[model samples]
Target: MNFDPQTLRYDERGLIPAIAQDAENGDVLMMAWMNADAVARTLQTRRVTYWSRSRQAFWVKGESSGHVQHLVDMRVDCDRDCLLVLVDQTGPACHTNRRSCFYTALRDGAEVEIMAPVADPD
Candidate 1:
């Protein structure tokens, strides 16, 4: 059967958590929120789109940052409440220029930064 964006479960704000992963190496890039429209838009355009809770608007990845996330696949969780977006990521996924937003590691009751930011092209 065909898929429908509306069929997925959403929270009270009509938003679902979406996790972006690198399709090539399986690194989790980031997590963001997506409304139904954002989901549909990402599928239609093959560019990842997210609903910014702070900005309250739709953002097409790499629209300004050049760190584009080209959609490779989109998977729904068994509960239908979460999404996994497999993508071909370009540049650093994190705004801080790291490969992932989850840069800090909590080990032995201590927090440590495991990853360093990538050097800017310019």
Candidate 2:
């Protein structure tokens, strides 16, 4: 059975949550929103693409930062409301330059910075 992007459940806004993860180590990289078109583009191009809620536009990962995410696999949740993207992440996945967007850890009711921003290569 061929998978279709429209078959996946989307919110009223026609968006779905997509979680990107490191294909090798299984580390979660980041979470972003994706419309059906974004999903099709990601699958077609093998580059992870997202819908920026704030910008209200298509956001292709690493388009500007060079931190590209090459899609290895895409999985839909059982509820068909979420996506898991296994990818080859090149650089910092967070806009803050951290390896992942989930940098803050709530430990014992206190927020802790577990990851630091990646230094610019040059």
Q: What is the C-alpha RMSD of each candidate to the true structure, in Å?
A: 1.2, 1.2
Error of 1 at 45 (Å): 0.1
Per-residue alpha-carbon lDDT of candidate 1 for residues 1-122, written as tens digits (9 for 90 to 100): 25689999999999999999999999999999999999999999999999999999998988999999999999999999999999999999999999999999999999999999998777
User: How many residue pairs clash (N, CA or C atoms closer than 3 angstroms) in each of the candidate models, in the order given?
Assistant: 0, 0
lDDT of model 1 at residue 45?
A: 93
Predicted structure 2, TM vs. truth: 0.96
Off by over 4 Å in 1: none
Residue 39 shift from truth in candidate 1, angstroms: 0.5
- Model 1 global lDDT (CA atoms, 0 to 1): 0.96
On residues 43-120, what C-alpha lDDT tens digit does candidate 2 reach at each position?
999999999999999999999989999999999999999999999999899999999999999999999999999998
Off by over 4 Å in 2: none
- Cand. 2 Cα-lDDT: 0.95
Best by TM-score: 1
